[model samples]
Target: MPSQSKLLSITTWLLGLLTLVAMATQLTIHLRLNFSLVNFFSYFTNLANLLAALVLIATASLRLASRELSPALESARAVSAVNMAVVGIVFSVLLRNVDLGSLQPWVNVLLHYVMPVAVMLEWLLRPPRTRFTARHVGLCLVIPLVYLAYVLVRGAAISWYPYPFLNPAHAGGYGGVALYVAGIALVFWLVACLLLIVPKRRQVRNH
Candidate 1:
């Protein structure tokens, strides 16, 4: 039974990897093309899909019930699921409608702030406590940084970017783009910290 559970966990990670890859690839292509296509199903909307796939994969991984499972793995998986779901749904709505100016500002609120907030709340309340450690945290940071760097270099080589925020010309400049990217990185870091720290408090309080 334990072996079977491990298999399931591995499968979940692999699925997440695939989803992240696909979304990242699509983001690269779309940015390179400079939003050339306006259709909902085209490259512009693929980010949401990638996010959805990631959310599903994370969900699967977090649901694993085994004594051998690590607390860190479970927490990471749970947080990733919530973040991805919020991102996916927002992107999906944005893709379906290009005329953001016409809609009420509150609509934007629903897509951007509300969804993420709800997801974050869910994550905070149900924080995981399993096989997590400092090493796992480092691995998490490294993987995303490596991917971001690789994608940026790849985009530069082809005179394309993977997202609007990555496009220096469209935004304030490369500096502006860099700043935005930094902000995103900070947010990711915060999420990681929250996931890592909160569980300890809960455990102690319960004890």
Candidate 2:
């Protein structure tokens, strides 16, 4: 039988490759349908998916390069894993109306759902050795906060927001946008805390 770490490495590497392929394929078709590169990258979903895929690739590469994992790499994995979790939850719970008309059904599923689930599962099942604290959890919000600021400012200026909830023209105005942002922020923090609680997996077979 393959060792647990070996199996996880392989699975994660495969996930990373598949996610990139799916995103690329979808983006190709999407761009052909009057979507500009700037507009495409502006979406939080694409950003989150890109982050997840890149981090997964990094994790896989680190494993390949050496058996011993560095703290930096592990921390990066943690952040990316949490980011993807947020992606899946936010898409399903909040951004249900953002149609992916150009995306094939399977690719859509992979980008929005399966990839996020896979990242979380990989973290839970084969967590790297690192103990995260409340500080780390607090820091986890940094990137998302920056993203929120960017989107809101850009949206306000150009009258274009990626999702309906964040769009001032459609998201019920400033106050409504605040409510949605606050709610999503709360959910993101809570989910980050949950992901940080990686139980010690003692055996591969049992898992």
* Number of the predicted model whose lDDT against the real structure is largest: 2
TM-score of each: 0.52, 0.89
- The list of candidate 1 runs beyond 4 A from truth reads 1-122, 131-134
* Lowest-sum lDDT 10-residue window in model 1: 38-47
Candidate 2 C-alpha RMSD relative to the actual structure: 3.4
Instruction: List, in order, the clash count of every candidate structure.
Output: 6, 0
Per-residue error for 121 in candidate 2, Å, reads 0.6
> lDDT tens string, model 2, 1-207?
257777788788898999889889878987888877887888777888888888888887777666666777777778888888888888898765667667688887898889989988888876767767787788778888898999899887888887888886677789999999998889779987876766323333345
lDDT of 1 by residue, 78-147 (tens): 5454344435443554333544432235434543444455445545655666645676556446544664
Pairs that clash in candidate 2: none
Q: What is the alpha-carbon RMSD of candidate 1 to the true structure?
A: 8.6
Clash count for candidate 1 is 6
On TM-score, the candidate that comes out on top is: 2
Compared with the true structure, model 2 gives a TM-score of 0.89
